[model samples]
Target: MDSFDEAVDSVREAIDRGDNVAVVSDPYGGRDAVADEAEEYTLGVERISFSSVAEADGYEMSFGGQVCVVEGCRYLYTRRVDGFAPVKSFLQTVVESDATFVTTWNSYAWSYAAQATEVDDIFDDVRVPSLSSAEIAELLSSDYDISEFLTDYEEVTADESPSLRERLPFERLRFGIEEASDNVFEKISGMSRGNPGVARAVFESRSWQTDDEPLDLSYDDAFALYVVVSKERVSRDVLRRVVSPDSLETSLRKLSDSGVVGFDGDEVVLRPQQFADAVSYLERRRLVW
Candidate 1:
């Protein structure tokens, strides 16, 4: 399962145990899936749109057992500054109510909303920002062997349009690195990570390597490499390939249960680091003591 799937599943499981939850996100990003999964998993769900939040106060008061799942929302609409007042008001209902909350968004908007809301202590906020280079370096320090994670990296493809990178944050370089790491493992035995695009361009350069070594790189690998070399985030597919491998699915699921890497659908993402001293913790996990 990707990061989205995992989050949905976790909330569903929580609801089954009779806990109410608030799953929030944009409309396009799969609100229905949560409803379906909640029903399928027997977790009673109630979906609330932000536009309906003012009306929801009574609903929450009246509904006793169902899990209140809110989706298709932004903390505030991007076009209007006036949007914040409604959002804050709606969030206040959630804060005052006895409900668990979950929200999703694109990294940029999420960060902005998070800053505007400043209600970190009130809600158990979970931030699933696209990975960055610093995170990859941090993961390497952990005892987490990435052989499994590498495969999910293969399923995702990079956008051919370079303009995407310009729109996304530089911190998202982790997705590119994870994708590239997969490519390096599958193709070039001694791939260099010095420059992001170097390894990928090597294959695309249309030169000596393909003619001499005849490396059998698939489109999946190509996409992985492209993101890596370009220093871009891996799209959804690649992240799916890494954590949801056929053989290791069960183990990965268990790891997910232990909250190591989170899943939204099939994409795998790391949790926010809890410890202040990540570098040392990573080193210990790597057994580099």
Candidate 2:
């Protein structure tokens, strides 16, 4: 797959032409790549995130403080819009600052906003694409396979099909990864859902290692993590209704400590990079509707 550079380039081109741009990407897909490009263009990048529109009510001061720190700093946000207020705040931010303002959104969330509000009027929008299988293979072939890590080849994928590491779109993306106790790369390719970030998470979960040197992650933990990340943000109460109490705290703690998820008081969210992984996991479990 192509690097998400084209979407990043479009935003850069818009800003150069003095037009603000809005980008919609999958949770683990393209937003940060755009942010990274923006950072390269200015003194600093003011990256902000909001779990919901209500949190955006008074973003002026937040945006202002950053502008003051670095004049003409690139301003970027990834706010999940549940109402019109965030769109209003986005306009308000651009209106208040003649400086360029760019916003990123989750693809599913953006589609919902398009129908519910007049967000279409505010900025030019683009939806980023998922990574290609070639890209996934390239990533997997790097610094993986402990057995291979110690061999002459740091990482090697079979030149053959169904050779887990070398395969792409390897299996049905919906069946949550296969058990770590049995197959590893099959699970990685399946659950990752053609998304780079999710594949990276599966790689880091260390599920590929054999029993002699194990990092055990249970199906419950995987599914619980999935519930928290199926959307941008989920309330603790909602999680309580879904996740078993006996398992909730443990799952939350493991995900948090592993940098896969985070807590905002009573709310739980998938950490930025971990979002794709959670999606892959949930899809595999058929827990997503």
Candidate 3:
């Protein structure tokens, strides 16, 4: 496996050579990190976030020589294709002109566009992978020293907290949780499916204990919430099929109480991170089918 720097450097080389790169990363994980790293390669970097076609239009008048870092392209219209035209037009400008286009995308958005549009055909797309264990160690050892914690310690302080890393915080979370128990990390690894965004999401929302007292929760209730999240915007009809009719409403209510899920009369929804974490949690517990 290429070291993180090696992988990043390869992309940096392309941008310096005036080649546009479409960086696809799992949601909320690597795109921003890649964009941040772009500054090291280019003399000047111009960052822009466009919500719609109208916004994309203004891009032409903005700047000239700097390498333009474009983000929120996935926000064109949620599906990443329906609203890609305007941005595509703007990007065409980047192509014909001298400016370099360093674009970023959410994995899901890129996946959809790949199937439905010429997005994949039009650009050089690269998917960033999660760092390896040794890579993680090599990367974070200098910034953190967790050796003392292998044996019991008084308590972890903010300075020593593994959560403090601004980038790849979730990767360190794996090592930290593993320090508590190897078995827990194994489940987290499998649950994340090696995706950093998914892994970090699991870490942030995990509330396995509070003062050594587990929250008042049952496997079934947690399972109910998991189903809700995995399905994405679960409806009452679908909820009835997964949950028993007798306890359907009660189970739903309990899941909502868990704070990981939100339910309006219309549907049950999970925040992006919560959704990924719940999927991992349920899979680890063997609660998913």
- Which number leads on lDDT? 3
- Report the lDDT tens digits of candidate 2 across residue range 1-289: 3447777777778777766566776666647667667657765456665554235544554554222111101111222333345456656656667666666766655555555565557667766755534445566667565354333122223342334433325434332333221344444544555456666766777543522211235776776675555345666655665567788888778777766778888777766544545554555666453
TM-score for candidate 3, please give it. 0.57
lDDT of 2 at 258: 66
Put down candidate 3 lDDT per residue, 1-289, tens digits, no spaces: 2644555775798786877778777554566777778866668788877643345444553676568888765543222224456556655676576777777776655666566566666567767876443333333234345354322222222233334322445654553454343333333333444445554554455422222222255676765665554344556665565566578778777666655577766677655434445545565676543
Whole-model Cα lDDT of every candidate shown, in order: 0.37, 0.54, 0.55
Residue-level error in angstroms, candidate 1, position 262: 32
Sorted on lDDT, highest at the top, how do the candidates line up?
A: 3, 2, 1
Off by over 4 Å in 3: 1-3, 51-61, 78-82, 133-181, 207-289
Worst 10 residues of 2 by lDDT: 67-76
lDDT (C-alpha) at residue 97 in model 1: 69
Task: Write candidate 1's Cα lDDT for 44-122 as tens digits.
Answer: 4454443322332233333443456554344233323354665565567666666554443333344345566654444
Q: List the residue pairs that clash in candidate 3.
A: none
As a whole number from 0 to 100, the lDDT of residue 137 in candidate 2 is 52
Estimate the TM-score of every prediction.
Answer: 0.37, 0.57, 0.57
